[model samples]
Target: MALPLLIDTDPGIDDAIAIWLALAAPELSVRGLTAVHGNGLAGACAENAIRILEAAGRSDVPVHLGAGQPLARKFSRQGWGVHGSDGLGGIGLPPAGRGVDGADAVAFLAETLVQAAPGSIALAPIGPLTNIARLLREHPEARQGIREMVVMGGAARENGGNATPHAEYNFWLDPEAADIVCQSGVPMTLVTIETARSVAATPARIARLAAAGTRVAGHVAALLGAYVHDGRSDALFDPLVIAYLIRPDLFVRIPAQCRVATGEDSRLGALLWREASEGAPHALLQAPDPDVIFDLLAQRLRQLP
Candidate 1:
């Protein structure tokens, strides 16, 4: 049976690639996409999600707009430089023909979880944790329905920060929300910056993708082309979450209890990892074979139309 899945995303340049990867994977049934404020505004993220599904000819999947800002912190102008102003590295695709779902992300999430079989649906949040956090706050009982939540955020250690001296961008954008989810007691697996930075998409890899001769492959190649210029790393951050679900052998899971710093100091959003005990909240991941992951990603992209 295909794994029931729902993705909450920000549609970053890499997010677009991740969505395509999930759509191409035969093992996952992506139920819907909920957009949050991260790589772009929530509205733009929803639009990008629609555009991505359109590109993959998977418009049957619904798209919903999510939280526009963090739970407590003021919104900041970030990610445009990395994901481009319009997201997708400003490689403008035509606007989506369909409209976003009227239901807000938090509501949609709650309804979806409640309606699905208990512990049968997986939630993948590749952006900030605002929507997930809100869902937990508004509908705490929804936890009973979730199978697992695979999150792509946080630096496992203090020195692993990608956005600041002590935080990753997604966690830094909404540390309070991260804190809420960390304590929500839902089974969680964290794919952190430590794992993402271990692998990169070099020009050679990009060439392999572009040579696949599929529309999806060409779109991914173009995104990577604009994303990984000047020797910049194109770590498959968001996609790794999806890949982990499809192929757990690609990584080693370290059971750990994680805490996100919600302080206003330099340590804000810093994830403190500790040894897991009874009833620990989450597990940290470490990738062992980046080449295997890259190969799998290429193989999957080639499967798309």
Candidate 2:
């Protein structure tokens, strides 16, 4: 049977590609999508989630809006230019045909975990940890029902930060939320920026995907085209989380205790990793072959409508 999944995302350019990959994968059955504010505002993120589902002809999946700002900090749109103002590289997809679910994202998450059998659901959060943190804070009991959480944030090393000198964008957006989730004692796997940056989407790879000639492949190409910078390749950030879920063997993981710094300085949202004797240890990804991962992504995306 396919693994039941709940994807918490911000619908950034890479988030859209990751959503499409998840929908196309036969091993995962996406239960729902929860949108949070990071790459875009909650409303736009929710719409982007629905837009991706519609593109894949999988509108059966529900989209719910989550936290609009960080737990203790004011909101900022500093990264909007990186993902485009609309979060889809300004590709201008039509408005989603369906509306977001009525239930709040936290409620939906708690209810879904409560209703599912123990260890039957996998939660993948590819954005800020606001919703997961809020859910755990409100309903700590829900952690027992989760099988494992695959999170796409954090930087293992101090110098590897993408947002600030010592922070990745997702964790930098909400350090308090990141702290809550990391300390929640839930089984977690962290795919960091170091591992993601190792996998670059080159021009050759984009051309290969476009050559597939499917609408999904075309969309993937466009997103990658906009994402890849001059003389630099786009990092498959969010997609690496999904890729790890599907093939854990493709990566080398280490056991470590992680903590997010919530200070209000340059160190804000910096992820601190260390060895621990007790507590729920997180699997920190080391590295994976970029060619193999891109090939896998290309094959999976071609399967979509």
Candidate 3:
């Protein structure tokens, strides 16, 4: 049976790629995409989600708009520059034809979980944890339906974060919400920024992807070209979540206790990792073949529109 999957995202350049990857993968049954506040404004993120689905020709899949900001912090002018004036690297991949399926992502998520079989659905939150936190807060029973969550935030240990010296963008955007989810007691698999940084989008890789000749690869190459110029590290971070799900052999899971620093300043959303004991339930991910992940991306892109 195909794995039931739900994606909660912020529609960054990489988030769009990840969503496309999920839609392209036949092994996953992507129930819906819930938008949140990261990489851009919430409304823009929703639009980006719809636009991303349209690009993939997966309009049948639902797109639910979720929290506009963090649970405790006020959203500011962040993520705009990171993803360009528009979320899709200003590549202008055409607007979506339809509107969002729903406005309440938390409620939709809870409903979807409750209606599905117990421990049947998996969540991939590749954005801020605002929507996930709200769902866990409002409908704790939904936890029974969640099989696992593969989160693409946090800066594991060294290398630092993109938001500040201390925190990554998604967690830094809403550390409180991240903390809530971390403490929500769901089985979590953390794909940290430090681990994802290994899959750098080099110029040679971009050229090879461009030369793939599929429509999906062409758009992907354009998006990468736009986002990865001027010596940017060019890590397409989000797609690794889907790849890990599809190819578990490519990664190693390490048990760890996750603690998100919820400070109000520079230290906000810093991820602290430690040894996993009985108290520690989360698993930290390590990519064994970060370069091969791009090959997986190419293979999957060939399967999509």
Best by lDDT: 2
RMSD (Å) of each candidate, 1 decimal: 1.4, 1.6, 1.5
User: Which lDDT values do the candidates have, in the order given?
Assistant: 0.88, 0.88, 0.85
Off by over 4 Å in 2: 230-233, 276-280
Q: Report clash pairs, candidate 2.
A: none
Which ten-residue region of model 2 has the weakest summed lDDT?
Answer: 274-283
Model 1 C-alpha lDDT per residue in residues 77-175, reported as the tens digit of each score: 764667766778767677889889889989999999998888999999999999999999999878878998999998976578888978999999999
lDDT of 3 by residue, 1-305 (tens): 88999999988889988988898888898999999988888888989999988887888989899998888888866646767778788787897788888558999999999998999999999999999999999999899899889999898765488888778888888999999999988989988888888888887888777766788788899888877784444886899899888887888888888889986656778997787765467988888665588787887788876
Q: lDDT of model 1 at residue 211?
A: 83
Tens-digit lDDT string for candidate 2 (171-228): 9999999999999889889999988889988889888888767798898888898878
